[model samples]
Target: MPKIALAQIDTVLGDKQKNLSHIKDYCRKAASNQANIICFPELVTTGYSLDILGTELWTFSELRGGETDQLLSSLSTKFDLTIICGFIERGGSLGEIYNSSGVWVPGGKSWKGTFRKIHLVDSERNWFSSGTNIPVFDTPMCKIGIMICHDAGFPEIARILTLSGADILFLPAAWCIHYKDVWNINCASRALENGIHLVAVNRCGKEEKINFFGDSQLISPRGKPLTSTLGDDEGLVFGYVDFNLQAKTRLELPYLRGRRKDLYNIDHSLIV
Candidate 1:
């Protein structure tokens, strides 16, 4: 089993430096707690709900290895920790913008993995391009994958990660008030179906006009809520995952092996 912690920080809208500093402070605390991996909420470096369509916030966005990436790279090395966080990525070779998440480790020249968001919410469709691939990275404790907010709503993303050898899925989200129940149900279902540990870090507090539901949660492979916290507070949510449990559950249940792909073209539907 490996212990992981989420630094559920309350980010100010459009403030990158303050958010980064706050994240570093939280990571230090996680290190003291001996967490093997530490995660932050979606758009953690720059506040979520920024007007990506407008010029005022556009200046805050960066390329994959821009200023924010360098800062994360430096912090990962300085703290000697495996760090995962969310940022609004700009200027990719494939597109103009992407809602992205990244994973970095100490002494690593490049990031362990990066995931551009595959799903988009209302208004988001206008601002960013969706990613085509679901990728995973091998870490010392387990195989890890990254997802951002809306990606969790789609079950195929979870299946892709699991099939790609992801033992643990790290979700960085800014779950708004209207979709709190959706977040709860979707995360649990993803964990149970894939037989993989899920660590979901969601933002707290209101940003712009959106009211966020701050139930940052960690769910076990068996669909159990291991630990959860709610409403506009900033702190760490910790959980320990046993990779052996995933193997045991999948073997016992045999759900993935007995799928009825022959009966229907599930992939034809937007979300099957």
Candidate 2:
């Protein structure tokens, strides 16, 4: 069994200082609750309004070993917990920024594996460079797969990770109020279909013109909403998941076993 915490926080766009401070406070709260791994919403340090920032957004994007990454790594060490957080990443070359999610393992000196957003939504294409890698990472408690805001809508991402043996999935999102229904459906459907526990953390409050619906949630392998904070309030949502249960679900339902890969084929060579 593992306890997980989802921090549904309100963020000020481009305010790294304010946002990082808020994250520390929630990390303390989550640590106090004895959570093994805690996750924050997408773009927790900088908020999700980068498209509005134009070239100024590049100023906020941090290189892999930058200050924000160091701070989060220290937080993970201080709390002795694994944290999956979203941040804007600067590639090796100039002007190459990505919408990326990363992990801070408790004993590691730096942020571990990172998963950049592959599916950019609407104006997001104008802002961040899309990622191609779908990486799964190892934590002390479980094998985790990472997803950013728009990635959750695509079933292939989850299926690919599930096929790679990710026991739990983390979705860090800034899902807007208008698409609240889609958010719920997507989260539930992903968990039920994949048979993996999901912790989908969303931001609260408004960032400029976008009003984010703070519905941070934790779902079981069977798609049960164990704990959720569904409103415009910023807070912590906690839930417990057992690997034994996940194993049981796979054994009983066994959808992956029955999957007809031969009949359902999407040729990647023909499509982008």
Candidate 3:
């Protein structure tokens, strides 16, 4: 059994120092609790209000192995735990920015792998470019897949990852209060249909005009809520993932095994 921690906290707009500080504090708490892995919400490093930042959002973006990565890597090493968090990534060329999620493993010097958000929603299109590749990262504990915010709404992304042999899916979202039902349904539906463990973390508190409801939860392969933090507040939601239970659930449910790929004539290009 692996212990997972979801850091559902409030983010300060465009304040890297404060955000990083909050992350470190949560990391310390998770480490103290002997958590194997900890995940933060989407755009946690610089807040989720893209329109408020406007053109200045680029200024907060950092290249791979930059300061934020270094700090997170060091923290993972220090705590002997895996850390997954979302950040604004600076692409190879100028003005190319992405809403990306990074995974830092224990004993590593930098991010082990990163997944950019393929599904951009609303204000996200104004600042970040949509990701092309859907990557599943392998770690000592398990094979992990990442979904940032709106990506969770697309069933194809989760199915693709499940097909790619992802044992667990981590969703880092900045979901608004209005779409609370969608958030819950998507999280449960993805986990149950895919027959895989899903950990969805959402940020809490208000940022400018949007209010975020923190209902971070860990759903079992059977679509049951193992652990959750309800209400819009700053806190850590913890749960345990049993690989044996996941395997058993998959065997009993057989959702993935029963998939009729032959009957589905969906065009590849039409997907995504």
Give lDDT per model, in order. Answer: 0.81, 0.88, 0.92
Tens-digit lDDT track of model 2 for 19-93: 889888988999999998999988888877766778877888888688878988998999988999888888866
* Candidate 1 residue pairs that clash: none
TM-score of each: 0.91, 0.96, 0.96
Error in Å for residue 192 of model 1: 0.8
User: Could you tell me the lDDT of residue 134 within candidate 3?
Assistant: 89
> Candidate 2, which ten residues in sequence have the lowest lDDT sum?
48-57
| Candidate whose TM-score is highest | 3
Error of 2 at 89 (Å): 0.3
Alpha-carbon deviation at 69 in model 1, angstroms: 1.4
lDDT of 3 by residue, 1-272 (tens): 88999999998999999999999999999999999999999999999888878877888998877889999999999999899999999887657999999999999988998999999998788788899998999777889999988898899999999999898999999999999999989999999999899999999999988999999999999888999476787998899999899999989999999989899887899778
Worst 10 residues of 1 by lDDT: 49-58
Over the stretch 39-79, how does candidate 1's per-residue lDDT look in tens digits?
A: 88887777766454355445777765777778778877777
Whose lDDT is greatest here? 3
| Model 1: residue 41 alpha-carbon error in angstroms | 1.2
TM-score attained by model 2 = 0.96
